[model samples]
Target: MAVQWHYPLMSNYPLESDTNNIAAYLYFFKVLHSRKEKVPDILDINDITTFTFFKSKSITHNHMSKWGLSDGMTAQLRENVPKYVQQINKS
Candidate 1:
């Protein structure tokens, strides 16, 4: 049997700015934790990053009143995780 898992953490907070999207993922965590007794294993907080949200085209659409992003800002974490993960897998 195959099991399906979803990594969609942005569904809760629609039209949220890139930096403001953390709460949405928090909502996902809350839901997953609600049934903590059933699923003993769940992804850890350090497992993923939500930076992809900023790269998305809908960045400015974070506001219904704003159809597009006029000004763009970028964020970079001090530690490069994905890069290291990829290199580790190449072995």
Candidate 2:
């Protein structure tokens, strides 16, 4: 699947960390479903106890937009799963 990161959102957005992740993943599925994108029907979550799923550069951005998270929070999702980090990596 071709996951695009540069979504329409990310401008002065505001959201909590956990909420962002859930909403982002939800959004990811939404987009994929909308476009009829083919993906493995079975989603192998990292751990059943935790709602966290595997992170990927390809799926990150589009997913992040689903939640009302700010760009700052989105930046944090890269290295830190908390959703908000003080600084973003320039890399």
Candidate 3:
């Protein structure tokens, strides 16, 4: 017997405009879970609530470093997640 590992196929440019796709969405969740951070159940969350949650939860340099982000990229994400979440909701 052989065991097969199944994983979602992620896009080459995960943050591209095609993020409206389910695969991109799943990739987001996968990254979140990989962090092992405590996240609320966001399946039913509205944009406002999601924005509020992200606003309340700051992403530290340590967290970003753990995710292998460069200092500049970490800073970008720290500044962008909340703002980008709004744009994402609109799409």
Candidate 4:
């Protein structure tokens, strides 16, 4: 028998970047699924980094409006994370 566990942390603020937490969790799931192993009782995910929302003030209003109007930005991040993770694994 095989079991997969998912523990999602819900915070008011974004973790690192928008969709970053989801991307990271998916990455871990992918790794474990490939190995077909049960999730350990104790796992460390404390290394994840978080970025502050306040920094958004530095971004241009145009970009902010675009993100609000469409799913393009979100879709891009979701698509990029796996490729980025695979690239990291090669090194």
Candidate 5:
């Protein structure tokens, strides 16, 4: 899925580290689940619990405006099982 990391209400912007970026991604999902809003059916309990940060890319302010970043975002979904640090390199 095309997860939009450049979301507003993001407590931190230009995420300083990979760890922080990953945390932000996970946090986004947490907020989505908490809101109990209309979410893609693909996001089942197991998917939500197992969702992992696959990748992210920077976006421009103009793009953010066009898409209504503050309102929330919808993107392609990538699913993966949680893995240990050592196994991360392999996957």
Candidate 6:
């Protein structure tokens, strides 16, 4: 029989930017995989307090909307944007 362990990834402020957040997630995922550890598919940043630097959630939502980032887009960005940027940078 085989046992599997689960590890949760937490972030203070997710999607603060397109680049840094994705970079950090990629680095963390690489480190964990190299060590034969489990990495969660979803990043846990659902804490309302950590959602934004602003005091108001409404303000944060406004900013996110203006930037054209929905929750789905932000989640997908972490997985897809970094790789594209790396490829562009390498060329």
- Clash pairs, candidate 2, are 13-70, 24-63
True-structure RMSD, every candidate: 13.5, 13.4, 10.5, 14.8, 13.3, 12.9
Quick one: ranking by lDDT, best first?
Answer: 3, 6, 4, 5, 2, 1
Best by lDDT: 3
lDDT of 1 by residue, 1-91 (tens): 2212234432333434343233333333343343422111212222223534433555333331232222221112112324433543564
Please give the distance, in angstroms, between residue 72's alpha carbon in candidate 2 and its true position after superposition.
Answer: 0.8
**Residue 55 error, candidate 4, Å:** 22
For this target, which candidate reaches the highest TM-score against the unseen true structure? 3
Worst 10 residues of 5 by lDDT: 40-49
| Candidate 5 off by > 4 Å | 1-24, 33-58, 71-91
- Between which residue pairs do clashes occur in model 6? none
After superposition, which runs of candidate 4 have C-alpha atoms over 4 Å from their true positions? 1-69
Candidate 3 global TM-score: 0.34
| Segments in model 3 whose C-alpha atoms lie over 4 Å from true places | 1-59
What lDDT is obtained when candidate 5 is compared to the true structure? Answer: 0.35
Using lDDT as the yardstick, the better of models 1 and 2 is 2
Q: How do the residues 1-91 of candidate 6 rate in per-residue lDDT, one tens digit apiece? A: 2212234343333433343343243443342242332222332333223212223435444454455445543444334545555654675
User: Can you tell me which runs of candidate 2 are displaced by over 4 Å?
Assistant: 1-54, 81-91
Question: Could you tell me the TM-score of candidate 4?
Answer: 0.27
Tens-digit lDDT string for candidate 2 (43-81): 212121212443554456556544443454445434454
Q: List the residue pairs that clash in candidate 1.
A: none
For candidate 5, report its TM-score.
Answer: 0.22
